[model samples]
Target: MKNYLILAAGLAFAAPAATAQSTASATGAAAAPISAGQRKAAEELLAATDSEKNLSATIDRMLSAQLEQNPGMKAVEPEMRAYLTKYMSWPSMKEDMVQLYAREFTEKELRELTKFYQTPTGRKTITKMPELMAAGMEIGQKRMQEHLPELQQAIAEKLKSQPPGAVK
Candidate 1:
């Protein structure tokens, strides 16, 4: 009777351990995976940069400057401005940018990124990034000018090889 009682107690304890293992396996299998839409939304959320609004404004200013500097290109300025305005539709752009950024980061990574962005240096970089981009564009334009003749010649030759009435 004593041996039988010990065996029963041991069986009782072992039963719960076996149950716990099965429960854990079931839960691990039943968990739902992330959907594509959910992933996309998270990505867009993360991609939202602090500089988005200021960057749009800076781009508008640069376009205006370009129109002013080259009067001949002024004929197309209105169309260009309209296109830029359409492309930079602020609310949707912001949403998409945020989603894109969010996709690349896990929840913990986003928390870290938000903490950094909240700091003074991060804020300063966010504010100045648009102006820095404009400066880089100005430098790129100078380089493009130097290569324009060669670029034009290459385009002309490529066009010449196309079939007659083909879209140029």
Candidate 2:
């Protein structure tokens, strides 16, 4: 559970810099500084989502499903479990996500979210968010897996095309 989330989180953390570099001509992270009120609203939304707990549960379910499909995974399951528990603990993840949310959204947007999420429709969305995120993650994993062969071929071609001294 933690392995997938951990890797995704790492990528997500790095994605912004890449995006910023790519979109340098675009509006940067400088519309306006996020206010304390908006920060509070963001924190409220985070609490309502149970973001970290939900991720931990989802990871548990995913790992269980994986182990079921591959019995051999049991051999290293204990070590994997220990690593996630130590490195991707709920407290650390929750703190990280809260900061991410605060940095990405404004107070006005967060306040609106607080208002909307309290509604019945919002409640449903909240309930289903984990399922949606998990499904999306699975789709992303499949797509990335699908690209591996082409990516590997591209790398091999690049290596072959380079001069002998370029390899060094």
Best by TM-score: 2
**Candidate 1 lDDT, 1-168, residue by residue in tens:** 343244234332222123444454556654334456555544433343444455456556656665575667677666765765565445535543444344345666655666666678867876776568568867989999999999999989988999988954
* Candidate 2, residue 65: how far the Cα is off, in Å: 4.3
| TM-score, per-candidate, Cα-based | 0.49, 0.61
Badly placed stretches (over 4 Å) of model 2 are 1-36, 69-79, 141-149
What's the true lDDT of residue 144 in model 2?
90
The digit string of per-residue lDDT tens for model 2 on 1-168 reads 554455435433332233433343255544445567766887898766655666577557656766786677788778766766665566646554555566667777777777787888888987887678668878999999999999999999999999988976
Cα lDDT over the full model 1: 0.55
Deviation of model 2 at 83, angstroms: 3.9
Query: In angstroms, how far off is 38's CA in candidate 2?
Result: 3.7
Superposition TM-score, candidate 2 onto the true structure: 0.61
**Model 2 score (lDDT):** 0.65
- How many clashing pairs per prediction, in order? 18, 1
Instruction: Show where candidate 1 strays beyond 4 Å.
Output: 1-52, 59-63, 66-89, 159-168
